[model samples]
Target: MQPDDIDWNIINILRESHQNNNSLARELGISEGTVRQRIKKLKEVGILKIRASINPDVLENQQLATIAINIGESSQLEAKAKEIAQLPGVLNVSITSGRYDLFVELLTFSNKGLVKFLTQELSTIQGITSTESFLMLKSYNRYV
Candidate 1:
């Protein structure tokens, strides 16, 4: 379903801060029921999700890293990305252009855990020709 102007406005407000139906309705000059229904429809259609995110840097013993991967077969990029997404500690996976076929973000308990993931878990996936990992040193205004 396509979102109308009202829906977009609702989304924009929600993006900045969590608002109840009454507040959204008052701000948008719409009825509370309309605001409620629109939010429901937006979520049902997978266009919107409401959840809290935390900065990984603030978490104790947690580390973040990104891996640039080159696979043997370009045709299998999507399949490989999906497979990698299911692995533990994997946060995000994407098929990309440039020197790599896939870019993956991972979250682990420590640097050692990251090594275990690279050596033990990721080693099981075939067709990955090579991977270069970068441990995140610092981030600003980043949340996961």
Candidate 2:
């Protein structure tokens, strides 16, 4: 189904409660079968994901950081960024239109782990001129 055709109310229900499909159906005035089918469809189309959203910091042995990297040459930017994106602890990487060449978000087990990623792993990659890291102080209103 197209984006316009899908009922976002189902997603709202999903965000509120995952286990109670019947409750969602009752609240939305749809059948359980319909909810399941729509959810399945959404998943298939990459529009909706239903899973446990965890706070990485609260979980033992998890670390999260945002790293900004500057590249010397503009031409080699995409290639170098792709190479860095493959490294462990990298959750998501983006090549943005900004002063920084690249932005990388990471999650790891410890400070040492992240240090290894920044120092040994990323530093060794060609075209990397400078690096800046920002440790998250607090995350607010993050919705799944």
The best candidate in terms of TM-score: 1
**lDDT by residue (tens digit), candidate 2, 1-144:** 664433588887667767576887888787989878888888899988777766774566667788998889999888988898899778778888887989998877778888888878888798888889887655665421
The TM-score measured for candidate 2 stands at 0.73
lDDT of 1 at 29: 100
Displacement of the residue 93 alpha carbon in candidate 2, Å: 2.0
Q: Which candidate is the best by lDDT?
A: 1
Instruction: Count clashes in each candidate, considering only residues at least 3 apart in sequence or on different chains.
Output: 0, 0
- Residue 136 deviation, candidate 2, in Å? 1.5
Superposed model 1: Cα runs more than 4 Å off: none
Against the true structure, candidate 1 reaches a TM-score of 0.88
